[model samples]
Target: MQARVTGHVQGVGFRYATAQRARELGIVGYARNRDDGSVEVGMAGHDDDVANLIDWLQTGPSAARVDQVTSEEIAPQSWTDFQTG
Candidate 1:
């Protein structure tokens, strides 16, 4: 799944926190800061895990003021581990 998380997502450790959460859920992918002040996440794993991650992305870390999270299914991609960039 790919998600574009909006609103106060930058500079709040959102990417790093996402990486941590993904690791906890055993999801594999990456999270990065977008130029548009959103955070983009690409996560792949069991269907349940992906869904869990998307749910988490809506609220993010304690400091994050997440306004929206838009996610969609995409063609499967391979990732050995979750990362932040």
Candidate 2:
């Protein structure tokens, strides 16, 4: 799944937390901050894991006040591990 998390996602450890969560779930992907102050997360894994990650993106870390989480199904991409940027 490809997701764009909005609101107070940036500057709040969202990306790093996401990477940690993904790794724990054995997911492969990447999370990065956009210029518009949103966090972009791209992940590939089991259907349930993807859904769980999307749900987590809505709340983010304790410091993040997530306003929105928009996501869509996309073609799967291969990755060795999850990362944050």
Candidate 3:
């Protein structure tokens, strides 16, 4: 799945926390900061695990003030590990 999270998502350790959670859930993908001040995340894993990650992205790290999350199912990518950039 691909997700774009909005609101106070930048400079608050959101990407790092996302990577950590993804790793814990055995999800493989990436989290990146967008020029629009949103965080974009791509995840691929067990259906349940991916859902869990998406749920977590709603609130994100304590520092994140998530206002909106938009997601969609996408073609799966070949990612070996979760990362942030």
Winner by lDDT: 3
lDDT tens string, model 1, 1-85?
A: 8999999999999999999999999999999999999999999998999999999998999999999999888888879999899
lDDT of 3: 0.97
* Number of clashing pairs per prediction, in order: 0, 0, 0
True-structure lDDT of candidate 1: 0.94
In the range 57-80, model 2's lDDT, one tens digit per residue, is 889899999999999888878788
lDDT over C-alpha atoms for residue 25 of model 1: 94
**Which of 1 and 3 is the better model by lDDT?**
3
How close is every model to the real structure, measured as TM-score? 0.97, 0.95, 0.98
Q: Who is ahead in TM-score, 1 or 2?
A: 1
CA-only RMSD, every prediction? 0.6, 0.7, 0.5
List candidate 1 segments past 4 Å from native.
none
How does residue 17 of candidate 3 score in lDDT? 97
Local distance difference test values of all predictions, in order: 0.94, 0.91, 0.97
Which one is best on TM-score?
3
lDDT of 2 at 30: 97
lDDT of 3 by residue, 1-85 (tens): 9999999999999999999999999999999999999999999999999999999999999989999999999996999999899
